[model samples]
Target: MAVPYVKGIMPVMDQRVYVHALLDQFEARYSGAGGQFRYDGQAWFGSDYNKLWLKSEGTVGTDGRFGDGDHEILYDRSISRYFDVQSGVRLDIDHGPTRAWGAIGLQGLVLYFFDAEATFYFSDRGVAGRLTGSYDIFITNRLILQPQAELNFYSNSDPARGVGRGLSDIDTGLRLRYEWHRKIAPYIGITYSNMFDKSMFFRENNGKNNSGVNFTFGIRSWF
Candidate 1:
């Protein structure tokens, strides 16, 4: 029998692409916690300013070793010299809760692109929603920084099985990078977040509040 790669059965493991692994520690009033590692990838096809992109990402909790996966496909069109529009479908693939969501975004050149995403989840756990926004600021020919924010709203949890409290979560973070030409760059940044009424889905995050500084150093480039 041929084993599956995504579910980590056997034989097919060689087909997987390794993307990222990191440990992030947080300090909060009630308890301290750590973040897990993440791996992600994107594939693109199409021509001109119009393209189809498929992306997949997964995370593993550092403490409890819980895992989750996300996959999405986007269709992008360049509307003009200074602006572009994107429409996409997102799928959350984990067993505990799964979701299908839609999003739209706009891009610009001067400061990269500014994007906003709205999500709706389909799960017995709850019908959750979230809003997110992000942008990049170029400091020099080789250096750039991005600050991002997200807010999550939720529907009441199932009285018997749900784990969330139907409140909101707010998260903010920044990323900085130095590019070597258009292909390679090393980066770093920080983030602070607050979990409103619900316990974080990850066991590592037991408390409702978290604040942390992160250092990132990686290489990215076009071949």
Candidate 2:
């Protein structure tokens, strides 16, 4: 009998260009404040090792008031199998006065499953930071439950924006989604968010609601 030889698989993980976009939250939120629309999404371009990332999120009330219109542009470099380092700038642009910050961050997966990101910001005003994480639990092949949370903090207060120092605020939600296709999911969820400590006090002084609970329905899609 003759013997046959076999070749092993070759690595091809980071050789070509790619583009991706995710509309993670595009929804309507109903609350005591009334009806509002919100969007949070990101798009990126490039190869596995290097890329450009654009992220933006905002909310609009029925009266056409826009809030939290945060946008960021970053250069991202893959540093490990589960992590990337990002640096760039962030802009807070809305109907109100605009603010800008220089940003640096780490974005990656955790424990082989959860998605997480930690970013720090600096401006003439002061230093700031954000941490966000999300995870999905499969109820079935096509049905899933996802929980997400985000926290924001600052080193100094910005009275112009009504931001307070210390642990500023938190947002969290629990959503159940059903995938009509691998690329699209529609979900319904309840979101609870509040400002904390001095931040809450500042909001009260400014005559603003410091917290809210909302019922949300939305579609999430990716390409």
User: Which of the numbered candidates is closest to the native, going by highest lDDT?
Assistant: 2
In angstroms, the error of model 2 at 194 is 0.7
lDDT by residue (tens digit), candidate 1, 1-223: 8645755444634334333221121211112465544444455666556677665655455444323466777786768776556677777675445666675555345444575555555455456666667676889988988677767666764322223566555666676767766655656666565545444553225431233443433444433
What is the Cα-based TM-score of model 2? 0.90
> Candidate 1 — which residues are off by over 4 angstroms?
1-32, 39-43, 48-50, 63-66, 74-89, 95-113, 119-127, 158-167, 201-223
**Backbone clash total, candidate 2:** 0
**Which lDDT value does model 1 have at 202?**
32
Which candidate gets the maximum TM-score versus the true structure? 2
**Distance from true position, residue 135, model 1, in Å?**
2.3
For all predicted structures, in order, the TM-scores are: 0.58, 0.90
Clashing pairs in 1: 183-220, 183-221, 183-222
lDDT of 2 by residue, 1-223 (tens): 5435456855465768999999999988888777778899999999999999999998786767787789999999999999999999999998667999999999999995899999999999899999999999999999999999999999998765657898888888899999989899999999888887777776677655527999999999999
